[model samples]
Target: MSAARHPWWYDAVVYQVYVRSFADGLPTGEGKGDGIGDLPGITSRLPYLRDLGVDALWITPFYTSPQKDHGYDVADYRDVDPLFGTLADLDVLLETAHGLGLRVIVDLVPNHTSDQHAWFRAALAAGPGSPERARYLFRPGRGKDGAKPPNNWDSIFGGPAWTRVPDGEWYLHLFDTSQPDLDWRNPEVGDMFEEVLRFWLDRGVDGFRVDVAHGLYKEATLRDQVRPKKPKKSAESMVERVLNDEPMWDQPEVHEVYRRWRKVLDSYPGDRMAVAEAWTQTAASMAMFVRPDELHQAFNFGWLGTPWSAEAFADVITDSIAAVSAAASAPTWVLSNHDVERHPTRYGGGPVGLARGRAATLAMLALPGSAYLYQGEELGLEQVDVPPEARQDPSWFRTGQPGRDGCRVPLPWAGDAAPYGFGGPDGTQPWIPQPDDWAALTVAAQEADPASTLAFYRRALAARREVFAGADEETVASAEGDLLVVRRAGVTVVLNAGTTPVALPQGEVLISSAAVPGGLLPPDTAAWVR
Candidate 1:
């Protein structure tokens, strides 16, 4: 964060685009005619995002995939999927986004590839002991006939982690069966990934968001994962259960992979960087991914999961700053992403939730580091309750889990009915249906309302750019019951997380998450003061 060495991303606000649900370019449904979001749709939305005040865009995978886990399972690294659009469409997106003053970051799913990827297909046809099979994790099952899986590990999406082949070998897929894990122990895998990095960099993409950044390597022994005894009636918090320091994620060897990737990024111009999606046991553990020689940033999930309380926020923020700063890297924060329920829904799912979400964002933007804004968050969109039959996330079909379709529902760009302004004026049904209530949250509607959530975000981001973006340190001005306050550069951020109001300090209020009545920060409200 030093003046001479500071990178553009150090204080940037990045927007995450879950491409398939973001927008649809082809009014006629480009490839599959499925009406899914595509590169063209993104290109058209560039000006809107640039105007929204984000410094960069982190676009999720749209690579050649079977769509089993949406785009996380890659069938081909070098080409675009037909269901999304074409390579030409992608080039147009990159060119347009760059022209709009946006840095585009695509996703890199190194943990696994689609079962249909050439390497995996060749591996299957190469039989049990062939070199092609060595590129992936293929282990012999247990028992005399090898009918049982090799270990007790389970997939992140649920069910057994290993899937059997007709050739009598069980392949590891920490996610879904369609995405077989690659063997990072093999030099070929690393070399190929390096080439993939160069291909996109050469194509002018800003960087990559490394998926499951902690999961490229597993324990060498491939030992059975240790398990804690089942608790009585779901006592463990969702935050604790997520990632869980599980055997499948956050391995020490993963750091080496990122160190190499950092070198690749550094070789390129325009201050290219990579942000890791690494879920670790604590903020301290998460910081390992962003060491100077490794990635530029690691998502601070421990901070993201902290309860809506003054105490929880203070403790998590302290640990996040200390650990990340120790690594000489800035902390990256996020509230909602494609994989999680929208924050408004998580906060409490009504007027209270929306208020809390806005306050939380103001506090996040007040912090002295980079932050990620999930698409639709600016409009205060909540997770839709997708019906079972309409659900598309593989996790739902595989494990009967609620799945992520609720958050991945197609965006409501405009219009008051189905499809919104997503595809085009002559749009068809969306991939995942948008709820009826989203008409009130469309960008067009909010753009005209000063009190709208969208307007609130725009103002907050502008104020940050003007007041807080350059500051690299924060000191706690106050952290008492129902209130937390932090000072950065001369600005004070006050958050009232408890019921009732807390009197604000005597200073000119720069911006407030909501209307502050009688100079008091109301419950679930946050404000920045000069």
Candidate 2:
């Protein structure tokens, strides 16, 4: 990552690829199930990513893991899982990405590790009250009452947070029982994570997309939390708790940790960046994750669930800019990810749903900050309807609710084939079944369709780079009803998120969701005009 002629991410587009479902080069039955997608698969897709006009790529966790959390439960920080590929494979992918002018940022789960990890395993075998035990938060094992967990805290996956070790005291897991939280307060813990940070940075990787970053620290008292008003569990619950808004999350000390990371980044020849997954409802809380010397960006989820009304959308943009404008940082918007239902499903049901998906993509990219385009989104892929019998998610199994399989459906690349485009060689099944209707949505099929959403994205990306490329930070002009108008560098973008078309007082209609030239927006779409 040599210093770009311009700032690395300024006006740059980002594409996020979830490793397991991206592409399957080794779609064979020799390894764990159908281990199709590997580093080579990603390297093979670099040209496609570059053609999409994305300058930066964020690959989800591929580190050595127990797969209990689907790579989130990291077992080795410095090693690549054989299931994904080897370190040599990673180097090839990195070299290929840079050759194509794309920067690579891998996911880093700093909050917890698999209980099978050497540290956790050692702590588990060390018995009670050992100094090594201090590396993790452990409390006395109880009796009779199934040994009540050390505290009343509940796992993000459900049940008590404490999991009793067979031979020792219970250990705390903010998430699943197999993913134990790391003790960041311990000097040794900090030192270990710092080494993990340097491992990739030293290897020429650009930076990281930190996972559960705010959840790195827990309450010192380890007290139980009072559930929020919407505590009722549902398929839509992306998080077990509203941890980002909690007092202990972005503690002042967290800044110090980021400062150290920033220092490490500075030691490199290029400008390395880090982004955090912090879910907060307001701009004020989201802004806390970004400061002069801390994280480069925090995922602003305020718009993730926002109504498609113009006023509501405008308020989010306005408030977000106001929150961070003074701090001289940028904002990021992500509408879809591996964890939640696809936007098409969340917005509506059918072709109308596809329209909503395209509309939202344009709206997010048209906004005044760096944007994240999820895998399959450019093709307008809808969520799969996962039946209960075939579900594999722990949350789904525990709560009897559908899990992320809907959004995490296998990717479709080839045209109209069984298992869609993700079919493995020699009749091997895909890791996750693709939507039956994915044949028409396969990347190959859409590649030839000029009116397709896929084409719309290519044009949209060009438009973003052409119009908003060097524009200064934008400000809200008016946020009324289903009309949101914003201006940056003398250009105003007015979006209509409603069913009926709304009147615009100024600016020509540059682009519309339902406009000619196969615009990406659907229904009453967003428009940009002078």
Candidate 3:
């Protein structure tokens, strides 16, 4: 699709804001006030985002919840959570973001709802076989004494996927026990989510980031997971096994739900759209989520999950671009987000990691589709090792895993000390403590340093707008000596993953992740040349 005909999201660069860690506005309880980030705090930071050059902001779930699984276990989809702010605060945020020319996309959790949600509560109160109970996946036990779970599937957060209630019926909860998966087969479920989508669109949200978009539907037969020859140990490996043709995930029926949702988004004005957080095993399967009549964009995690090598990057990018193009939808690239370890840390931690991360950022921006930047990435922030006592992610408790607390540490906006101006005027401590060593990495520090990572991001983003705004064509020039060269529009981006520097193609330099010495791109560096 051409830029003129496609929606703004097609060429947009989106920033993912993890709300609780972004900033704190209304501090109301203990320790210099509650210290949890709120909608008002996000509103107050609109100018910063606009200056950052992101076309839109995708805020993580801030809906009413009981704090289980953070805000992902939403109890009410229509209202904002008290921990974040009131519905009015969201209105102010939406208005302010729009005023600053930044679109806002909120998280939409359709696969499940918190056990405390009104419908779930009613389902619990009603007897088995009641219509209210039918809203969720409540099934009878399978054993002769009705003692065993209906299926042998495991929860993503660890433990059996089925949780037995007081009524002796088992309910499916793919994540946490408090987050019961909804039965999308029911017409009420689909209608409710459609209305939910309209409710937010009516409130002026630009679009939605559909959470677990591949998981809304499951196989009709709740069969046991097909076991592998050898059991996977680590959480990551186990997840990979489950995501590959699992009965409960990436079901073909899920497309029907998005086809209907596409109509809802289309009915709204202002080019509203939805991006799916679908996790499929292959690029083609991921592409299916963004078919013409489905979501506008689906995250290209194949690119995200690829190893730091020129060949690996080229293969994934080639496949991703081809798949999405075939589906007649724009591809979406994401390097870091709330759920994973920051790319900086993942690339190899410390200075080397930061260099690779910066290079990766430029390479991602050079692509011919939308990109998503996690908060704090521009500051070259590395994952902070939160003390075990300070970790709040439910995955840590459920799986005995370290969880995602490291990536969710509060952003250091300014100041040289802890909290780092992340809180309100009272200088409250952030929910998760910031590392004292991050003084030099604060936005204030980076803004003053022209050669800082933050500055590089600003220049790269600005250059992208100038050179590749409507440029969709991308051709792989060459992959030689661990260096990958890609030509997009009239701009050539050279990424060197090798240990030694490499000569750049003949062109004027538009931007570089690092200073080019002797007209050669340094190792772990990337540059855009016109």
RMSD of each: 2.3, 4.0, 2.6
lDDT, candidate 1, residue 307?
Answer: 83
* Model 3 residue 426 lDDT score: 70
Q: List the residue pairs that clash in candidate 3.
A: none
Q: Which of the two candidates, 1 or 3, achieves a greater lDDT against the reference?
A: 3
Candidate 3 residue 223 Cα shift, in angstroms, is: 1.0
Provide the TM-score for each candidate, comma-separated.
0.96, 0.91, 0.96
lDDT of 1 by residue, 74-102 (tens): 99998998877888898999888888889
Instruction: Give lDDT per model, in order.
Output: 0.88, 0.76, 0.89
In the range 1-530, model 3's lDDT, one tens digit per residue, is 57677678988999999999898886475434367888888998899999999999999999999988889999999998999889999999989999899999999999999999999999999979999999999999988868999998999989999999888999999999999999999999999998999899999999999999989888988888776777678968855764555889898899999999999899988999999999887788889988889889998888778789998888777888889889988778889999898999999988899999999999999898899999999999988889999999888898888999999998998987978888866767888888989899999999999999999899989988988888756655456769888887888889999998889888899889988988998999999888
How many backbone clashes can be found in candidate 2? 2
Across 403-510, the per-residue lDDT of candidate 2 in tens digits comes to 887887767887666555454554445677666667888888889998888888888888888877756644555666666777765666666676665565464566
**Global Cα lDDT for candidate 1:** 0.88
lDDT score, candidate 2? 0.76
Error of 1 at 64 (Å): 0.9
